[model samples]
Target: MNEHLTDPASEGPAGGWGSVKSIARIYGETLSNPAVLETLKQQNKPGGFMCVSCAWPKPANYHPFGFCENGAKATLWESTSARCKPDFWNDHTVLELRDWKDHDLEMAGRLTHPMRYDADTDRYVEVSWEEAFSGIGAVLKRLEPKEVVFYSSGHAGLEASYLYALLARLYGNNNLPQSSNMCHETTSVGLTKVIGSPVGTVVWDDLEKTDCLFFFGQNPGSNSPRFLHPLQEAKQRGAKIVTFNPVIEQGLVSFVNPQSPRQMLTGEETVISDLYLQVQSGGDVAAILGLCKVVVEADDDAKTLGLKRILDVEFIEQHTTGFDRFVDCVRTASWSDIERESGLTEPDIRRAGQIYVEAERVIGVYGMGLTQHSKGALNIAMLANLLMLRGNIGREGAGVCPVRGHSNVQGQRTVGIAEKTKLVPMDKLKELFDFDPPTEDGTHMVDAVKGLMSGHVKGFVSLGGNLLRAVPDQRDMEVAWAKQELTVMVSTKLNRSHLFPAKAAYILPCLSRSEVDDQATGNQYISIEDSFSHIHGSIGKRSPASEHLKSELAIIAGIAKATLPVNPKVTWDDWTGDYSLVRDLIEKTYPEDFAKYNERLNEPGGFYRGNAAHDRIWKTPEKKAVFTTPDQLNSLSFPDRPGRYRLLTMRSNDQFNTTIYGYSDRFRGIEGTRDVVLMCAEDIAEAGLAPGQTVRLVSDFEDGRRRELGGLVVTQHALPKGTICSYYPECNVLNAIDHHDELSKTPASKSIPVRIEAEP
Candidate 1:
């Protein structure tokens, strides 16, 4: 327990009146009186737009208010009355604005017009859309196709993502690296190898029927609040919930659904987790291996007693491969190593194993915690092995669920925003668009940065997101960003990324998901895929923030038209006029998954994109799911040194990916600042530091670069000894650009090695 934590509310149940107050604060700050009520009523409704926040699935049964506090904040944040017109940019120079806080920059307002950075004046001057697009096209045409990278954020809708991908392929390169490369790329790579699917097999219906829910390294309360409702319901129905994380997250402890009038009025809370294990940082692989060891031992004992087999022998034999090797590896793992690495005793591991064995069905939910590590893919593969021991996957109420952060990150990938050439269907693409996409593999986020730094990539075009803040090694990224010959950002507002202008930079304003996108045909509806592999339509009811802003589809089309040669088969004009034409192209490209894409938009809850793993149909080369064994039990190995700790980067309750909403993390007892580091008291004292002491975190990476973040106040919290937690983007500098997962190349942001030094 965090005895010295200041905020008392952090110890209380999540949601309830606290959430209501937060929503009110956001709405009050951004929206007017009547519009607030209208927006609230329409949020997550059939005809209304999706909450441009977390990608948690919308419920089939609608509640009075379907959106969560963060979701409401995201909606109002986009719909804010503030606007950043030409005059505002003229007032502030790029150099002066670079020092402004990320939150302050975005709060300045939504961008109203296309603007170009004038290096001589160090200010952004308003420019016509045609001139901006033409200049960008001219520069892109000067470089080789592989020299330009097209980066997409998760916020892009499916139609826009499809067109963006098509534009990139038509331009002759597949350098379509997006935000997911930094987060869930491990899940995609690991799961594909294990179960023959990149996406999760679980659906919304599974949560309702699950016998047990295991949360690994994810805090749903802060990341995705609406997920708490399902956890509360699961608890009420006698489902056992277990959590394995370094911090004792408030959401995993208990929940009070704000939607439930009776519970809210009575102040009653549902206890969420039956067992909470505070696993050490980067210890998930060890913990999972321990559980598998216990299960295997128990099965061995049962076999000796001639009793009914505890393991799912029939399912294992029929549906899985590599089981014998996986079991052998688990059996060889020493108990002492597991306990020492996992920071959990033998009894606790057995206790959790017992719950898994007893539960008829179980769903393993995780987020960036398990993915942003050197062995991130192995971490996921180990979790899959744990579920496979009892055949928990490919069954009702059971599967591996990787909770995605952005609204449509998975959907963007599904539509074709990948750097890997093999991930996209080249034959269908060539047939439909009559162009041969580059066979050479393009760059992921890390490699893209390297390309920029080395001057190999000359141009960059972003669909959305603050790429500068989202990536690791901030200083290096900024320096690399400036090396680009041309940089184009298609965004809703000003961000830190825009401040780091290249030789030729353009910030083109685009319609947000919450704003009405009126095309030549009529008001357009875009489709977004949730984390559960469910695709649905989102139609914005609010008016556009600025008259000069264009739809993402239109901006993508504009770039396509200006850059690529006219293809008789490709119709950018028609697609821009009606987004359904873009959907038609998408359906033709992925006929199996997106058949009848436009018609399904009218369905009440949309439709499931469908995963072969759910039907026990493995798409692996061997046509069977495979159990994998890690070369080592622990994901990271650190020497025993004083003043050294593993730093876990996290988001505050008031923040989303790269976008800071406020300084306070309401759920975590943080207030008035985002520069505090949450450390265990034992670790603090051992490092000759006290609570509230100002310290600088220094990370010395294998690349021979020393990264440091200063002015971070040390605060005591409930975390594993020798491990600390701090908000991301601030601490992202501590992670080296090249320090990432071997297989997935996702940055190892969650477990960065750092030493705390007291600031004079």
Candidate 2:
């Protein structure tokens, strides 16, 4: 397969008529007619369903049509008219479906019936809901609690996730692992240890009042386009924007708001970044350390001159610890090492540091670029250190913001869907449910995969995600997944994971966030938390595609009722009837955070959970924020060899995490295919390769395993020399399962060492 290349759009801005056209095309393809306008209007509104795309926060005064291009794609993708019925499943065999592409499988439409894999015929047959639930429970009853792994995706709502977590604990284990383990686990672990909070301290209003916005490894234009509105407004108010990324994402260069009629008519583009430092892949740690060094040296100069000290000495002395050690570590870092690792000169680093020092209030935003590396947690800690130098945390308009991918991923963690036993309030769970919750640590994503491969884990339960398509070492995950005794997937549509069935596999259709979910009591509303830690209600307005489809909350409750013995204190049926009862239970379990959960959810723009760090009240052991130094100065170490390059995987403009929307990547000037590797012109020639040539990438690892991806077309890009980029999941084959951060266990997908060779 070869990719069709084209010059990227250099005329219009990022979100102008191009976005409008893309939205129209998706609606046309999905046959989302008459309901399109209604769905678009309701998205991100006060009483409307949350967009299932990104976790960007909804402003108090939200736009009438607040949806972005990708948001529209997600909404229509879920609300499409096409249906996958019993007939479709009967005609297609599991072995045949496994050969289909990820995009084609999802385009087959929403699952409309409960299905069970028939090993005799190698095909799926429709099964009654009761029979499916009872059969799954029978298998669960026979196996040890530790043998089953319960997984969730960001697509699940807060109500469903809370019940899912409770069901796992009540079943006598804490083996709950979800999407965050692969993405922002580093941010949560690093920030909690330093500031005593896992979530970002800044809110939506803070973006509007900030003096400087520093973006590191985050591309909001594609991942979260709604965020561009804030950046546009911030730029207009004279705020400086600095970016540190390997690729010059179009979204970061300029933007043209489709919501603004004047800019749409005039074609005027607002420039986004004042300084764009193309940092090498996995170089965030060194770059941040260089910034810290500059800040500390500037403070010394200011003190010598008897001028105002550059550091926030009062805030540092009163509210923090270990600052002296952190400063000493930064002062000792070598300038040459910083330049070589960061791929930038001292002048550029000083310019960015000067911008940081001059600003009164700054907000630092980042994404997987920093967290998907071996030094992921350390990268987050270094950024926190830089912010602390100026007393950025716990302030009105300043803090660190980690942009999450899924709409409710952060919410899922907030509601106790974690693998760590100590992360949840075990005492509260036992008191409310009248059962002794498990105390042992459970498996995370990587550990779960290892368990399956080793045959230690016998069953798999997924609330809403394609595990096989999202994780590393895809070729091995599929084989390991097939060996499970039982597999259950509760989802709205069919994906690749559903095809790789175990001895006993079932696919249960569920109501999506866009469709109305009616229970025994009345219409139901689910709550979702955004990246800003705000919780709000989402009421789906569209009609259901099938009569047999059940709500996620209902399905989870049914599974719990069948698998666990009835407890007098826990009433699954009543909670499923009315979600408010679940909220009451949540409030009782987390009195400090979820107090008045249902009442406050009705407020405009919802309510903030209020991080202790934001109020300058650290909850650490010493009751103060602490700064720590990284153990290593280098982000990555590679042997000196020719034809070696650092390969990073990214998402196309037309895709979300593993969910490919189309074949075209308009931002990168590629069209008609996704089977291509982006490389710098110099590196291409040095390797005796040229643009449009098909090449194979072989990963270099110490394990001595042969990990290669073949038949990938080469395309020219503006990346730094010795660094290459490709789309994720497709290129995940090159990422070894064990190559990840030691502390957080996030796969090092952003910085894989690989060699390119001509495809034989």
Candidate 2: tens digits of C-alpha lDDT, residues 1-760: 0011112533346799888887777787777657768978998888888889999998888888889988988988887778888899667888898888888888888899999999998888999999999988988888899999999999888889999999998887889989998899888887888898998888988898998988999998789999899999999999988899998777888889999999899988888888888899878888999999899999999999999988999999999899988888899889998998888889999999999989999999999998888888888888888999999998878998999999999999988999998889999988888889999988899999889888999999999999998888888889999999999999888898988899989999999887888988888999999999999889988889899999999999988888999899889899899999998888887888888899888566779888888888988888998887877764564553677788999998888888887876777777878889999889988889989899999988668888899889999888888889998888888988898876888888898889888986
Worst lDDT run of 10 residues, candidate 2, spans 1-10
- The residue pairs in collision within model 1 are none
* C-alpha local distance difference test of each model: 0.87, 0.87
Q: Over 4 Å off in model 1, which ranges?
A: 1-11, 31-33, 637-640
lDDT of 2: 0.87
Query: What are the candidates' C-alpha RMSDs?
Result: 1.9, 2.8
User: For model 2, which pairs clash?
Assistant: none
